[model samples]
Target: MTVPKGKLIIIGGAVDMGSNISAQENILQPNYIKFFEQGILKRIITESAHHEASKVEVITTASQIPELVSTEYISAFNHLGVNHINILDIRTREDASNPEYLQRIRKADVVMFSGGDQLRLSAIFGGTEFLQILKQRYQKDNFVIAGTSAGAAAAATHMIYRGSSNEALIKGHVQITAGLGFIDSVFVDTHFVQRGRIGRLLYAVASNPGILGIGLGEDAGLLITEGSMMEAIGSGLIILVDGRNMVETNIYDVEIGAPVSIENLKVHVMSIYDKYDLLQHKLLIKKVVKVENGVFIKADK
Candidate 1:
């Protein structure tokens, strides 16, 4: 398999873009401020080859409130000192084929997908020239593809389109479909911890042990390089469910709507600074120590 030259930043839901809450609420909740002000968005800019000069294209195709999301993202990026940003409000199949949008995509350094419905992303850009250009750029250039919520979920080869957290363990409860195919053999689910989505992600992996399941929590994300090396970022948790060592599972035999059973399914929880290798299926953690100056520093494990 050929390794990709670009980067993929997959973020869980609830990334505050300075539009979700009022100034008073933001002042009261400083944590939300950190997420946008000095967190994931900042990292996205830093990872770009040209940093602030990178031409960013915000694809609001997945969002229902495209205008609101576009305005919010523009504010967020401007706050981070990134001025070259454009919002691509591609809402229809024909819009996905627009020559102007295609030209803009060719020159863009970073492409960001906002949170909304994953199916819209797949149905709209699945086989279009637009997706083809994005894939080519990802494979050959130092491009960056960042997505939050539904955008994150649709970055993988297989996507979980429908699944109820309460009944996720039941056979056939979780629905799977082809996604944008930016990454393979991986299934990503957003709003993980906040919505209790582990059951659905587990079921996805249990059904297909070859596929790795990643559950991303709100305000959390992973910065992936070479399409394999993943560095955990943001302030929330990230769950990895590995079913490769599974000894037994009754998902196939169990009747629909019945609870399925699985044994020896391995799970790993990660936080900021943690690293996970998608190809090797290994986890590496970073240890930190606080100094006398009341500052934290990395320490050798």
Candidate 2:
């Protein structure tokens, strides 16, 4: 059977919530209030299964602190009034194969992966039935798979296992490994601008020109529909590193620690409301809207 495409909500880390921040610190800040009141979790809840009968299954396998991460997600989702929420703490390969956990994946309308070590996610659930069914559901059913940070990175086929910002551009500096393979056309990175991951993402695209690089900034996310068009949401930026037109490179000749040389790398900075066409490798500009005399109107063509 041909697997149908589903939506993906890929969030960068440090998404705003009251869990980590002290109440006293955010009491006087409007942005903090907004962050707590209407952040990515709200969006996730809205896009998940039917409001009256939604079933959200959160997988906290990536995190070392699974209990804390699961609790935070439950608290956030609960605020949105999702009907049912469950956390699958599949810590070991044996845990991944648990029949109950497998049933949870089969019945969930939305499956969310929490942030932690990407390698742990890959190592534990790489070839298990749980992952297979999850992929199948995403392919054949109207399922939603949302992930943040490490979870976001592992959603792609090719994942960046490890790399340093300082030496990212140098050949052999970044390590690549097989990920869950939910989306295969692009390599994803999170905590992007906040953590200075541009270099590593650039290198990933440079080495494999066939794939595009997505760098999601902290507090930002990309809501992808039909597996192609991406709508940027949240408070930060989304960086698209397109190397299709790259003209020059010295990667093969360079030493391990030598700087990489390349030219004509195209990049697009997308913010909230901006859309990106992944298949065409282009940014889709929306109709410009303007405020005229306190009235909102679309700009004339």
TM-score of each: 0.93, 0.89
The TM-score of predicted model 1 comes to 0.93
lDDT of 1 by residue, 8-73 (tens): 999987875555541111223423534555578889999998999999999988877787677778
CA shift of 235, model 1, Å: 0.6
How well does candidate 1 score on lDDT at residue 133?
A: 99
- For model 2 the TM-score comes to 0.89
Per-residue alpha-carbon lDDT of candidate 2 for residues 136-255, written as tens digits (9 for 90 to 100): 888878788988888899999999979998889878889989999888778999889877999999999989888999999876888887777788777678899999999988877888
Model 2 off-target regions past 4 Å?
1-3, 21-33, 286-301
| List of clashing residue pairs for candidate 1 | none
